[model samples]
Target chain A: MSVVELARPIEKARATPKGPRRRVTAWHRWLSPLALLVVWQIASATGLLPERLLAAPADIASTAVELTQAGTLPTAIGVSLQRVLIGFLVGGTAGIVLALVAGLSRAGENAVDPIMQALRALPFFGLIPLFILWFGIGEEPKILLVALAVSFPLYLNTFSGIRGVDGKLAEVATTLKLSRGQLIRHIVLPGALPQTLVGLRQALGVAWLALIVAEQVNATTGLGYMINDAREFLRTDVIVVGLLVYSALGLATDAIVRLLERRALAWRRGFLA
Target chain B: MATRLSGVARAFGDRVVLDSLDLVLGDGEFTALLGRSGSGKSTLLRALAGLDHEVTGTIDVTGSVAVAFQEPRLVPWKRLLANITLGLDAPVTKAKEALAEVGLAERADAWPLTLSGGEAQRASLARALVREPELLLLDEPFSALDALTRITVHQLVLELWARHRPAVLLVTHDVDEALLLADRVLVLDEGRIAHDVSITAGRPRHREDPELVALRTTLLAALGVSPEGRS
Candidate 1:
């Protein structure tokens, strides 16, 4: 209430609008990538290294266009995306079931959790060899590898989400005399969905990364395979083109999830926004 | 037995919050729980609402029992109408009716976050009302509101209570609040019913009337605060 106390906060509020303008100088957000591209082009023109070692941005763009015309680009991307989708679904469902079991029953945690934790600790990429041996180097192994890569994120998030749900809300549910199933459907699921969504997005990202690794080895036609094949022929242009497609796909998928999250959480807008 | 809790003794570790407190909320009586902080008023409401399991009591009630938490814990994800309708298995036309009672029918579609504190509390009241509860447990229902807001809400609550007339148990720290509302005010001090004061004041009773003033003095005295200069 004193003038000194009042003045400081008032001054800060007045000054705060200027802070972002100063901090986020226009080029900081939009121009850094364009600058990097310029440097890349300049380096290619300098020719200190062979053209194979460093593909110019223009060369990658041209290769991308050629691949698009041939129809290989979209097909590779589609196959990779489909595999990620199926694998994420398989793994995500099982993770949710396990999270619920562990959340509801203490015995389930004691009995099943240690093994799950141990499996979670084992590098999913390392499991590729075991999967290859068991299911053979084919689509099944690749799909399983994608699933294996994704499962931990889903399980961890789902489990923590269940654990982290407001006990106060659960008490509210109980006071209403809701049945167990009703409690799960109305209160528990919605309560956990926010965090579970975070897990789902994270799993999708990991799955996309894993799909690349899975497809790179063996009789596969995917962006990953294209990159690996390009590597053998030393076609840096194609490799750069594949990396761009991979990164773009990952970015686009995450953007979609972000949009869904925003829409799903609309009711929370009044409080959190 | 419409609503009953017998031989109820609730303790938290070494602290006995409610001990051997046998209570029976009659079929249609409004009972106000008055107590100081740590007097286990909220605890008793929680027990009756069946949210607390630590209590050793048999709470028997006819139909559903709905509670309005002290903080108006409206489901943040639900729209105002949806939050009210959440507990009803039988579609309640009364959801809008309840919202109207709380003067929030206009805000039926608004997210709870957009609500003022009073509005949020009103929405919570709507939620309990929609359940058509046989017993309604209110824990410090108006304690969080400003004095002006509290008065308005109190009038609204009294009107709604008149309509529904569920066996109501309201808890509050404010002595005057307990006095203004209930047919009978029960004061708890350290887990026991230290004083049970019956306010024989009629509805729309004037606060400055000699009898009601005397009764207020009596409650203040019972709480060990002398009504000397205050009166």
Candidate 2:
């Protein structure tokens, strides 16, 4: 509306102009996977692997279809996933509570920390025998094993999270006359959340791995069992099928955690990512 | 309520920081505690805040305390509103009101990372005020700021203290800052009170009054620095 104002140097006001758009989009994200599939197909067609010994993609695909038709794949995944959920919820909650107790009280830390540290250092997979012996080979042992595998990471992370909180923040908490519970709930928990979440995410992956390892010998209705049953007749196709299912499931779980992390660690986006 | 620190003694390893320190803070009085670097002024403030339990002394105060540290120490994960409300049992609405009081209403939902140092310190001040503390403690609350920001915060703290009427104990190494904000200045040297000078200047004190200039010159000399043109 005013020629003189329009003629003023807008460059000084804005300083930096927006740059050109990038050619990159997410359309090419699948290229590497597609290329890998092509390579697998080529290898199968070229007879690089023995047809019976190593199942071709087509054989594995047909096996997958058969398993799908028989409702075995869904059932197996259901059992595995159910076990994971129960174990993670129970284990994660207990770990956080214990961590808080130990972190807050010097006596509790003295009594519990060394034991927990030793337990955490022990090879979790090696404890399967003791768990079986103690709890029998029922679903109890399997579930408990998954829970045991998860507890250490969650507890350690939560403990460190509590310890790592800034002392100045605690001083402020005291200055305001915050009650013990109030201080832990508001200051300690949020301050240690990122580390705790990291622990929970790590524990989740460990739970899945532990569940699969648990399912190996006697499990009749999980992906591990499916693969074990396949190995009786040497059906590597079904083994590959099991491996694929497990990988996809793990990827989905990790993506869910990462989505939660984006919300949890939204503040750390620039620094962390 | 009055606060008294009687025969307060603190030592770190072999070095003595505060030796039988005796002081009384009158009701609603503003005192600036001055000392050299590593002079344990912060330790004294922390002891007053009930943070240093190992220190041997009877620190008697009739009401609750609130401390504003040199660093804002806001929770990085929490929003400005949440950080200010962290130690309270009150509802979120009350926290929002406190943030609004500090002119940070719009930044209520913004994370602490987005705040400037001055803004963060203001939020820290808001945090202290939210508790309505009877005694306020500050340790070099504006040391990290430029002159303008420092003066702004000094005025803000003075205004808040004037309105809230809490006994304030502020620790700083800056002589000019001591003159600008304090009712009385307690100078510490070699772990002892070297001087306790009263500022006779009236309320809303001018920064460069003759008395302030005289006191500033004296404090600088006590701090072992030549006036104005020291190399």
Candidate 3:
């Protein structure tokens, strides 16, 4: 006999929609940050907040402008960005390849999954000393550290994503007589994308964290080195500028991924409806 | 025969779903399979579609086959037109033609999730029909719709079947549906055909047709259900 149709009462409930929510005005999101900046400027003007403890927003901005003029801040940012790009590419590629290998075959999964899971259990920071000892405090250790940090989250997420594809959809592929490559390209990968994007966002965050920690341990370039140099000279203004740059970079990368998600998953209509 | 299966047997860990079952369909014939749930209707359909490989049978199919399951099973990530033409060697215009045939020509660009149940099933039917298979398997494709929508879909399927002229195996348990749609109806019981009843009633048969009503009674009785309460 035919199966009973599942009643989606939730769709009906959603149709009887409520009034539109109160929209946040254009300036609302920026208001809090602007208010904090004004407070910082006032404190610094009154000399109530010491520069050694916390540099004022104005001083930090001036320091950033001076550094950019001297080419220090721009050079550091360029170097840091380059490192992140290289590390992310290497790690992301490896993660995707490994995920496909494990996701597609029982033999590949049996051979690879356990070792990766064991390695994943090790804290990323714990590898610092070993990395330094092996790679000798050079660019190798720093980039490798970032790559390693980026790989695990992407690998886990991609594997789970591939696994999470609907079996019924796969059956459709088989009934359609789709070849293995066609099945992978048309069905499996597209099905895995929503989960894989979740992994990507997480990996990007972890990548920045790893880069920060790696550069802090030993580096002569990049944002972390600039912060380290500022600490040595007690120039809290330069340090605050470096911190803000990091935050801005983080925000920018996150925004990029969110945009990608919107474009790629336009077909998804769940709560966005 | 457009499709033939002989001594087909399928089991899951010793629980036989289909046991030495044999079925044949003539070219351009509309056949309906009726069975209670778990009586192996889907199992047989899957075996016929070559989706169930572990079946022990010698099956001979004359040409390509396409299937529409109870669910629409359209790829959620694909547009309706793309879903219809997926893996088919047909051009975009053909997909448009199939959509027009299914009365969903305007919805070709819409997402599958955006369509209601009946509309999505129409899209699914379009997907199957675009292939122009010699055998078309319908695993209760209209069972999910409301009664009114089901009648509309029934009419649509009859129209499409008349145009395509593919040998159809429509798996359903509704006696009136079988009387309305199929030239021949088979009742599956205990993993075998318990009754093979052919309806000679004229085309466009109504639910209230005297011959159809009698056939429904006989079909219901063969299904081991009393016609008194149900009719």
Candidate 4:
């Protein structure tokens, strides 16, 4: 039989529609959320929902624009972005290095994996009080906190990814007379990459969470600091705007990782959805 | 001689898989090894391929060896052409030529996951052939293919073998496939070659030939199957 004949069934299965063919436009997803925002705005304008409790969407938007023009919001965002970038770099590098050491050799795994597993068991956020005492309320502790939170997911995933490489492929490499370095470069690392990217996505998510919590506790200037300063003045509009910015940053970073996944894992398209 | 194995023995725990086996293949010879389930056919092939280091004996191959396994185990991350040239230190043009030979020239840049089973098997064959191996070990490579695809691949393998003149050792369970392809058919029993027969007939030998019909019955009886379609 021709290759096309053999592949036709799989193609048909994938092409078959599972449900109703009604086309749902992209904006349909936002319909309910937009309606809720409208209801909240009407309530705020009618004085039913007090400004002390929460800011209306319109008020939050105006506050965001005002802060942007005044350069306060931009500065806060810059500081927060810098902290996450530095922390992620440090933690990401450490995680990958450790995973390589542990995953590649038996001696490395024996020396490193036990300690890592032990350390990973502890709730990382619980280290905040101890961190503040040790590093003071400086950028050291804040950046370190984000680094700590970011490292575990990457280390765990990368280690498992490396370990999970197919033994069959390794055998094939051996039969092909691949040198030691070539075997690792061509087979093991590439095999491990899909899982490593998954770890990256997870690490990024936790990095942002760690930064927000760290800034909340003892930040002199950042989005978290701005929110804290607004709390004293009861500026709910500014607080709402800061919260929105934090979520937007998280979503934007996630989208970037998704794009990277698409590019790196293009080979996986026909194998799975 | 292309390859020789003397007193090669392998055992997993108390179960002996290969019991002091001795075999030889002439240069550019096509040999088919047949065995029932658990008859150590794969063990012997693995030993010759130098993949089973625990096989206690001497396995001397004159030159390079390559294997195309049943699964066509291509690295999923690599394109077809890259898979063919993996670790071979060959130019892209050589790999492209091999792809063209396998009728996969247009799929050189395709991901392995996207290829159908037959196409992937052909790519696997290209990968092995690109090495220009002196001994090509095929471990049931065509067993997973449909009958028509198997026939096509069988033809392709014969064509490649003719052109490259590589000594081929095909491990298979199909009696017809062995009779159709090999210069010699060997049946393994009790971890040793129990039946070794030579097919001296010319190329494109007829399955319905009186001599082949007689040989088939003899081989079937040797495999402990009755000629009357009984067990």
lDDT of 2 by residue, A1-273 (tens): 233545435323333334332123234557898888878877878998676677778888998999889998999889888888888888888888789889888998998899898888899889888887898877887888888888888999999999999887787777777798988877888889888888978998898898889999568777888889989889898899899998899889888987887777777653333
TM-scores, all models, native as reference: 0.90, 0.88, 0.92, 0.94
Q: Which TM-score values does chain B get in all models?
A: 0.93, 0.94, 0.97, 0.97
Q: Where is model 3 chain B poorest over a 10-residue stretch in terms of lDDT? A: B222-231
Report the C-alpha lDDT of model 1 over A27-75, residue by residue, as the tens digit: 4667888998888888888885467897888888888999999998999
Q: Write the per-residue lDDT of candidate 4 for residues B1-231, one digit (tens) a residue.
A: 568888889999999988888888989999999988899999999888888889998889999999999999999999988899999888999999999999999999999999999999999999999999999999999989999999999999999999999999999998888999999999998888899999887778789877677878888888888779854
Enumerate residue pairs that collide in model 1.
Answer: none
Q: What is the lDDT of residue A200 in candidate 4?
A: 95
DockQ of every candidate: 0.68, 0.54, 0.64, 0.82
TM-score of chain A of 4: 0.91
lDDT of each: 0.81, 0.83, 0.89, 0.91
Winner by lDDT: 4
Residue B37 lDDT in candidate 4: 83
Candidate by candidate, in order, the iRMS in Å equals: 1.4, 2.0, 1.6, 0.7
Q: Which stretches of candidate 2 lie over 4 Å from their true place?
A: A1-29, A267-273, B87-97, B203-208, B228-231
Between candidates 1 and 2, which one is better according to DockQ? 1
The C-alpha local distance difference test score for the whole of candidate 3 amounts to 0.89
Q: Is candidate 3 or candidate 4 better by DockQ?
A: 4
Q: Which TM-score does chain B of candidate 3 obtain?
A: 0.97
The C-alpha stretches of model 4 lying farther than 4 A from their native spots are: A1-25
